[model samples]
Target: MVEKKYDVTIVGAGPAGCSAAFFLAKNGFKVLLADKTTFPRDKICGDGISSAALNILKEMEVLKKIESIDHHKIGYVKISSPNGRMMTGRYPIVKNFRDYGYVVKRKEFDYVLFEHVKALPNVHVLENFRVENLVYNKDKVTGVAGSHGEEKIDVFSDYIIGADGVHSKIAKKIGLFNDKNKHRAFAVRGYFEDVQDLSDAVEIHYDSQVMPGYCWIFPTGKTSANVGVGVFNRFNETKEAKELFDLFVRNNKYAKKKLKNAKMKGPLKGFPLTLGSFGSKRSSGNVLLIGDAASFIDPLTGEGIYYALLSGKFAAEAIKKGEPNRLAGEYYEKMWAKKFKNREFMPGYLLQTLMGSRIAINAAVFIGSVSKKRATNMAGVISHVLPKYKMIF
Candidate 1:
């Protein structure tokens, strides 16, 4: 048995955990980043990165490394309705700047980020370690006990960060997993090869019949793309996701035509899409939750990578500046409220409304059709900041 102490012990080496380690280690804090899996592990994701996320990547200096791998410069977004209405918005790349977003393989992206963080002097990476329990003193967390291979290790840290994705053991152990307002969606996604007629724009098809959530086709290059559909799990309790996916691909015009002759290159996998924040009571004692452990995924689009990165940074910043007694919990709560609380709640509210009425969906589609700029603005409002819209007509 080996015992170690760190300023921060982060569970999960996904985007959020790695980003937190990167920022904290750069600031001279000792960080231990642990994950159950090794590098280049596949993650189930939409593989789309937004402009806001790109800015964070640039700041972290992993943008060049990402570019060296297999990626595609996404120039625009195509939103399609079931009734054949479509709208396209272009995100142009500025001079001396990379494009707004890129489609990347999570294996490569996570590996690059982990490598960068592991190179830091004050950081130690423990791979293939499963965190079994959190050692607590009364209500305050003091450390985590787990095993690396056949050896047992207990790591004591000033703070613990849980970035371990949707099924976070840390979150479950501390009684932070709540399903009160939690809307769970099941998504089946995979990569494909030899896909033709795919545009540079990421295409999203909204058809209520085949899939309640959106069907997305994101291009990674000329001959390959990431294609998938996300559906409300409650709707598929008795149904098979594969059957639904096949029916969707066979019947939908866009899916049928686009993936007509494409070959599925990888295994189709499913994962839980968590919606909304972890409430105001997510933090307890010295244990703080970030990323999926904190339920930071967007309810509407199911995009979480950006929120994950943002929350990770905020958590690391809190640990770096805040005092252990009074500031740890306060700092965690304040930072989450200031940065992500609104963004998480807005989409949940809007999705609830949209899910309740077809008229509302029609109205949304109508508004988007009337003005792409306004719709984009509306998306920005719900996803980033809420804006006041006064009807002129």
Candidate 2:
């Protein structure tokens, strides 16, 4: 067994963990950033990086690396209703922020951030480390114990951050696991080459076959995309996600047209999403959760990268400069509430619930297609580039 000590032990080296590690290392903290996989590995995702997420990436100083890569820049969005009504418009622009977003494969995106963090002086980057449990000092989490190949490793830290995705071992060890399907969704994605009519716009198609969810065609190039479908776990309990995906590719009017001549470039991958419900137990004692572990994914568009990066920043802030009188967990909860979870975002959640019905989605798409302003508003809200209230007003 090998023992180590650090100011913080992050259980995952994905966006959230890397974000936290970057900030903490810059502040001279001894940080241990570990992951079960090696660098440049593929993560199952839609690969759509929101403008909001790009803001954080810029701060991390890794955005330039991503910009230098051959990535798709999304300037527009196209959304279609179940009955085939469609709205296509430019993404709404805000002052000082570019209207366009990017779609880079996770292998590249995650690796860029990981490389940036791994170079920091105070951070220890561990690959192929699988966390199995938490070490407790009389009920207060004090460290983490995991395996690295054949070696057992134990790390002591002041705080343990679970940035390890939805099925986080740290989250479960801290008793925050919930079985409710209301806050969960299932998504499957596959890359396709030569997808026809692929534009700079990210496309989302709604249908009765996958209500409470949508299928997305996020272009990765001029003629290819990461195409996928997401359905609420509750709605998907009796359904097969792969079947739903095949049906969307072969039957959904818009998707069929775009994918009719497309060739699948890889295997279909499926994963669970912890939708942003906000009420999940985010922190306890000296342990905190971020990203998917905290259920920060958007309920409407099934986007998590923005929230993941933002939550990582918040977690780092809480640990580095939190009030001395308050627990870091308490400060983290406050920061998360102020930044990501609040009353202002409630309308979006309500809309996500309403989106379960085919009639509601069709009506909304019809309204959006009526005018350019309406279309822009629809795209902005759905992409989380604008507040939900803006769409209603």
Candidate 3:
């Protein structure tokens, strides 16, 4: 097979890859976005996109398309403590900010991304093609070897991006996948139809039965919702995510109330969630990683799409600075850290640690209910609408 040359090659066609390709293409870089599966595929997630993620989509010029689809505009997150005490952290009305989040199926959300990126003149998208191996010259990644259907294709590029996801082949091949299981979280999500009392607010329940874990019900459509459960691996104790979600739905009181008339739209699906490890590495040689491949998911809310798009755009900006061949990984790492570490993940880690105790969660609910500003700030920080340091300093 002839090795085709391009300016940049990105693995994975999800939010990260597509965002990176779109930016790079607009900046006049010849880009290739490759993925193993076709669009409209499902990935296990909470299915909630914060307003920040939507703002990025607006910048990409695809927000209108997503808006035309059937989805719910989430305005706030309603929190129910283990003792059934409910409190809402409504997104504060920031001046000129779109004060709403979105809950759309990954099927529709990701398809819009793929279609938008594919229309770029300098961008080529390869679906159902997996990056089989990273082409390297003794640790310096030059490009990739991929399998599209039955044919093997070799593609060469000056820069490589591993946006493939948690099970990224590029990350593993580049020796970036250190097993930090303690830093990982596990979760399961599924769609349900005929759900009763489907509210515009995304509801999260913290039951004592699932300590260090929470169940979320996000309305995706008028009668359907995406329901899921999440538990930090540190306290997971070998419990199956699917079984845990089932038990929660059957047992949790508030869940029973809300889901009384709801029927499961599909079987519960589970997936591994990689968390951001502050001060951890995210690049090597001529390659940089983004999204789940770089463990950019928020530690508290599991909002990967926000970081995925941000990191992709940041990587493209860093690549734009590389004039004489390829950009070094350190530049990408530094850029990612400057933007996300102190500003994004630290507050998430703090809140995640605090939520470990049922008492702490109850206290938070009480305080947030009485103090509206504090509540909005806390909610804003978690939802990525406000800076994390707002809660700290």
How close to the true structure is residue 128 of candidate 2, measured as C-alpha lDDT? 98
What is candidate 2's lDDT per residue for 1-393, written digit by digit as tens? Answer: 788999999999999999989888887779999999899888899999988788888999899998998799998888888888898877888765668899999998888889989999999999999999999888777899999999999999888999999898888888886546888888999999988998889999886666656899999999989999988876558777788898888889888888888899979999999877766659997788998888888877888998889888888888876545537888898888876777423565787777777888888778788888988887776556788766656
**TM-scores of the candidates in the order shown:** 0.91, 0.96, 0.96
lDDT of each: 0.75, 0.85, 0.84
How far residue 342's Cα lies from its native spot in candidate 3, in Å, is 1.8
Show model 1 residue runs off by greater than 4 Å. Answer: 92-99, 233-239, 278-280, 324-326, 355-357, 375-393
Off by over 4 Å in 2: 323-326, 343-345
Which lDDT tens digits does candidate 1 get at residues 159-198?
8998888888888888887554345677888888888788
| TM accuracy, model 1 | 0.91
State the weakest 10-residue window (summed lDDT) of model 3. 322-331
By TM-score rank, best first, the candidates go 2, 3, 1
Candidate 2 is scored at a TM of: 0.96
